[model samples]
Target: MRASESDTWLAKMISPQSEDESEDDILYNDRKFSWSAGYPHWEIFGGGTRVVATDALTSSSLFSLTEAVAEIIKREKVTHAVLIQPVIDILMKEQIAIKLKKIVILGTVGFRSVLDCVGKICDELVNMYGMVEFGTIAAGSYRVNDVNTYKHKVLSVKPLPGVELKVTDDNGHLVPVGDRGLIQVRSQKRFTGYLNHASRWVDQLVRTGWLNSSDGGYITTDGFMVIEGRINGLMDVFGLKVYPFQVENAIKGMKAISNAVVIPIREKETKFCVPCAAVVYHPGSENTTQNIQEYIREEFAFTKENPIMASVYVPQVVVKFKTFPQTSNGKPDRHGIAAEVKRQIDPKKYECIE
Candidate 1:
């Protein structure tokens, strides 16, 4: 290829977490390339068994995904893309809406996160892109048929053949539909056992032919699985169960915050411990730490109907970050972020939580 035709974008699949793993630059190649098939970068580049011409333009270090895509469309004469759901929110605002066709989201964090941003995606892109085929994947839980029309925009994951799903509570009892519980599945597709980690596999995964997904969810009347959060080892506050995603989504909804991550904060005085949120805000956001804390308090204010959950679920602190530290897989590094919070948090500011 000539220099003019060679402008492929290589997206960041993951980054190293620690200095010890500095030698390991987690990226895709011929062997591990299949893992990236569902991501935007792979769709752009990574030569494979594609019948169509999917010439990708590399743009890895950019802050705004939309901006990067915009450049690619202009330069590469691109017309379609298979992007993750999170990118659609920002991408919809750009002029690229008039270009793309398909929008496939590989839902690693569940389909609902994409669903939350679907309105903007459909409204902004659908009319322009001509009824875009936008959907997400949730391993064994969500399927192609699960993606429905706007009014019927609910997640319905049909368990595979010979896969029996069980949503059980703490004591392994079934909960009613729409009520959250541990998601256990006994499937032919499920792994029989780990290679050598017998104890770890038994303790964390397989139990009586059923695989504990370490996920929490509820089945709707229509057989749709509404994911709540991770079930294995969730963070707590004063003996009250709190989900990090719940708090993170709330913070992300704020006008000032562009991105958010909620992590477990270990406190000796607190009975169960507390939550700390590290956020990346919009440019020109005149938000102070007090304002951020106040916003969380108001958003998570206790309700009279059930004062317990709302009260305990609220964040004890919120910290600002230029960019959240990411794990090798491009996921938020909660532990690394927590350590940063500890370093930045003032004694006087956080003492109130105790």
Candidate 2:
């Protein structure tokens, strides 16, 4: 398609949309416009009355998704909006809710599933607009499947809203239910191959029906997959596989701990290894080292592996100055925090007490 023609087509797809249009059609167009809702904001039409803002209400399409969300809420005139996954609506600077006459979300794996992450937005809409008149979330990609034609094709899935795709692991078969593994996705819309590699494509049907989806998840009895963290975050101590979120959740509710990251540190004396968790305490709270150690010890008793019984207790919890570094979507950057913890911990003082 010519650039101008393509732009027009895209404009219609991402447009803030109106109540009169059919919901399914609007969702399809928006995905065609941009899968991740690039930038933050995009104007719905040439001279339309409404705008989509990620930050607040504004009349511009050439902005970030965050900005577009902001604009839509401020205008409050928009009767309908197609909120692509990962796109958030901010109110008074925090993501209070996504406002639209009607809102539809596309779903995928991970915590940002339309229902999980979008609850707060839905709540805000109810509080302000007296309940959502119409809302729904579905797994089908609005871009890949030509809802009108309904043709089935491979590698036609849309790209994730904003994130890179890589082969996280290649040696193993898909893990059993409840086990975590790599997340792999095969898509033609993905950016070009790396510097040393030639352009490549994965035939999901040949090796596995779906892209590896390097993320680790387990098939719940109810049939929904629960995405655990990444493959890189999985730790094996004395043969028991450890998922950080499992540990984080155990300690997350503690009143004194703001956050926690579990890391595997090698011991020089025994030439063996075990997990060590560096916790960030609530600001201004006097964090006593003894109490923190006891917390980890007590919490792990409820876990499947119970690493605290085998691993050494960390001496001083690394207190970061502020919030943990976050990926673009606001998920804590565990790898980044692990690196920071390694740098801060003194090697000579590496001693674990049971």
Candidate 3:
């Protein structure tokens, strides 16, 4: 909106929207607090009140996310801020870094990956943004983070006081410490089942009394958690297991790559799924499919003697992309990227055997 339209827009939008508004009235595409209306989830922590904010109302939210946070709150300063589901796309992280530096303890959700995105953006968050402690946080549609618990990995979160969470393997056994598995939760606050789809509730949500969260992560010795990614995205190639994050992480670590996604593309004739990559490289990067393949070979190929090198799950093809498509949740949409990659690959010309 223009400067003249500011007042007109302000008159229409009620900040921190009223608790009295109807549920249907409160939720929209841009608004974030759909679960609890517009009340910013507040916690009495670190002195005063710690306000949690997110890109609920994208246009309105980004204003608070990047600029005028303290002014919008009408406070001298915002001591603590928790961000969730806001910085989903990769490029937006730079925007957030440059703009969001006022709050002291800025807990955000930018880098849900294993690496702390603060490194990617540089330490300027402290000098420029008034940030002392900043890390990715764990908060989502179904649950809130343990108000008292804070950690480094953004996805590492503890369920609320009344909730019981379990990390389990494929056989339903509890994963040993440091090993990744599915996160399952049981709580009175949790939804019992989805309406009309009772069986889907069993398949997707309810696993006995516990709800299968589908999120993948590992618990630490001290009980802090580190989420990896979705367990359902696992791809199999020639009977070997391949994980998207594992391949993507390896690719991103390469010097030439700026961003990368390893997506599973199923071979139409053989029906065997092969891992392919969509890469975004630094400007003027001399990256080629052969070199990218070599990087993955060096990173993940088990050994020549182990047969994993021959059966390696590295990208068979590396297609260049200007940017990644955002998922509904605003994260990088690997499935969407895979669909685009499939269109470019000719099945008759290219082998899909990995």
Candidate 4:
């Protein structure tokens, strides 16, 4: 099917209005298309079909509760599967194996860690990037045997057909390849406007066609896109900018940490924001708070050229969590965790780095 038509069908399927509309009304709108018409069914494996499973909240756009139930009923052997990062984490924690041939992972945060865990189970693993506003933007896959060697490409995604991406500096000028900047996207099949939020749409539109993704990332010289994190999520510490993903990625790289989230917490006296990390350690890990803190210091200290800037990235306070609070869509609840971190931290005990 064409991209525009596919988008229209997806929008209708997930829109709030869809709850009131009948299946026929959703499938046979003004386009006059049938539900099964032109639906391409690819034989990804030898006579094996794909089965999807999601634990996301019902309100998630990825799949409705009803669709999830139907898919669950139809699933049997589960040769191919699609899952989000959180679901994959759960699988790893539970020590459950589905014995799948192929898997496609949806979300971005902590993708590398999850890929490392699941790469051994499946023959092929694909990392997909997309949002509700636009359909599948970019995707890349790695074979099971190449997992360790291709770790650098875990977050790299190549744009899909007809999708255009650019990284621009704060001044709205394009940056050189491999330089970090604000990421913007333009596509022929992109959503036009919000239901009643036209002004919001206008604010995000950089020009007539391009839309500001509000994401900070860089493009590689080889033409792959790498998303760092949300532009708004960047923390300013003593006049230095630090990306939470960079810190979280470093923390997760440690042998003990299973998952981690870094947030900016403002110091009471100076009112300056400092990075605080909440971590989930692997089962049976005997590492203490001091060990994790020392690890971060050593990791950031390796950069001799920017010791001052690297110091800002280190977390002043570290808290341990059994598991991260999750949002409705099953992603880590960063804001909620930040609130809890503030509550747990005693301002008098830990002072901000000067």
Candidate 5:
């Protein structure tokens, strides 16, 4: 729609692996914009909508664009808004907690945008629209849990009446009440099919009426849905479940240890499973390795248990001029960090598992 909008589309088409193989100037604009969490420039796309851009969010000209949207929303009292948050900054988490009617998030895979708050508004919309016969739309199993939990989070499409809803777990087991699995719906209202693609949707549906969501979790023992982390993110620590987000959330509350990653490294001694976290200390704080270990033990106590043991040791905390390298979609790149950790520490000293 706008000249800057071309930049957003170009960014989407550019593959992450291709960037290293190409020239720097070819990938980005010379004009400095705080569009990304790092770097000199980032492209932003804005049409007619309310927007909120924080300085801490990213390094992109997006702030100027979002400011324009924010003014319009405040002035027009717009209800539904779609905005793309910067990659690392969880703008939805920040905004959902604030005053706004509803905001839809749009972004690419690397950006991995999420909608955190969707509480009361969904029910009102359902009441207003449910009576009218609507068509069905396909969604992952996690959507059921997300919708049930955030009952007020509204969706544009409603499944037609008489549509069958099925929920299952990752193991392909049909869960009973409160049990959660992948979800699949069958109804006449389902779309005719995909455009320019025929086989994409087939891979998602199964003969047993379950669609694999790739996200793992279960329905509540109380008939509610609970969404765990993605299956790809599943870390089998001696057969125990360990979620990186859970660990990161705990570490975020700690004093000096600002950010940490619980990477499975092979221990030299017992050859057992151990996690080594490469940490980033808070800016302008005197954070030594010993101080960080103590903080982990006292404040966010997650360690030494079956399935996993928390041998929380901060071998070294490197000081960075800014936040770390991020994925194209805006999420922190754990894979990239893991590679960096290999460079910093000997892999033989830590426990390593697939």
Candidate 6:
């Protein structure tokens, strides 16, 4: 595609401009768009650096996409990269030979193994957290002075300048430090309102002017923030609550597993939700569904006093996949995975482990 045509196509994919928007509204949105696209990081990428898009231009499998990026980095002699966690994992697994000076991680929290792999190759590794509604909320770079200290601060992110973060319970009360709750943000750079969606924006904003992030997380005593998962993605098992990321994190902890996404599947008879894991095992791994289920059972095993807690956390069913479906942006498609799991596995076949 021609340069102008390709730029237009990518712009449309990011956010389609509308002819109906007023001049002021268009100007406001343009500013917000630049912020979300990492405008603040331009200084790091300055000084006549040649930048290339990491995303694949055409539809391709995960492996092919990895190969494509490695080729671009090598051919362009790129020194820096900003990538999502999944892309980092693929590059590490393939052991691609593209050297870099700095890497900025976006989209999701970096897995410990992935971070370690990148730390060895890159001089600097930065983790950034934000949403499209707001832009670049919090970001922190690993201390290059000590590579051993990087893993400990993988989840610790500092709020960006002029941005404030707080965790609140369901009743809108502030939760104690280290207690998981809904994460909220107040920032001067936040978008005023969605295009023609003023009511939606009002609903998300609280009387105190904080925007509800709809993300479940906690803050440390030292004021570092740790995001657990999306609050809306929580599963209700009987009466207990289960976070999908908690289960997925436990499953991925196994050496055999490479990646996992835990989703809720509602029981046909009772209509109650139960966690089901869709896992992608490492190549040459001989682990089966039963083995993964057993691993999780042991990971969350409880004593006689609190045996019931184990059931709430453990996934009842496990399904293996060669690769997960990806969206346009190359992130794992959670909705597509949930739909595929329901179509392939029968909920009645597996019984909850109690």
Candidate 5: misplaced stretches above 4 Å?
1-99, 104-167, 175-206, 221-223, 239-261, 277-324, 346-348, 351-354
Model 4: per-residue Cα lDDT over 1-354, one tens digit each: 111112122322223221333545222223322211122112212232331222122434222432453355247766777665545554555555455677776645435666665455567778777644566777877776656655442377888998888899877799999888988788766454554434443465636577776667788777888876566577788888887877887787776776788888777776778788899876566467777767877866756676666558877788888777764334567767876776788967544332
| Tens-digit lDDT string for candidate 2 (1-354) | 101111112221122223455645322122222112232223344332333222123223212545766565567766555553334322212454454444443222222223333224442111010001111211323221233342211102223333222223356455554444554544322322223322122344245433444345444333333444444455555566666555554554455554566666655665455566666554444466566666666755434375454354332344343445643323355557666666766676453322
Give the top-scoring candidate (TM-score). Answer: 6
* The 10-residue segment with the lowest total lDDT in model 6: 1-10
lDDT of 6 by residue, 1-354 (tens): 001011112331223233443445212121212221333233223432322333213445556766777787889988888776656666776677667888887766555555565455577788788865566789867745645654332366789888999999887799999887888888866344544433432465745668877677888877788776566577788788777777877787776777789887766676667788888876667487777767777777755577567667767678788888854344567777877787777747543322
TM-score per candidate, chains pooled: 0.64, 0.46, 0.58, 0.73, 0.46, 0.77
Better of 4 and 6 by TM-score: 6
Cα lDDT tens digits for candidate 1, 1-354: 000000022222222222333453343333322222223245334544432222343235324656776666658866545554345544543324434433444333433334433433332221111000111213322223433442222234555455567788876789998777877666444333333323342454444665555567678777756554454336667676766766765666566666677776655544346677788765556477577666666776755675556546666667888766754334455667777887887654453221
TM-score, candidate number 6: 0.77
Error of 2 at 82 (Å): 12
Error of 1 at 185 (Å): 2.8
Q: Which ten residues in a row have the lowest lDDT in candidate 3?
A: 127-136
Between candidates 1 and 6, the one scoring higher on TM-score is: 6
lDDT of 6: 0.65
Which of the two, 3 or 5, has more lDDT?
3
Give candidate 2's whole-model lDDT. 0.40
Clash count of each predicted structure? 6, 44, 7, 0, 27, 0
Q: Regarding TM-score, does 1 or 4 come out ahead?
A: 4
Ranking by TM-score: 6, 4, 1, 3, 5, 2
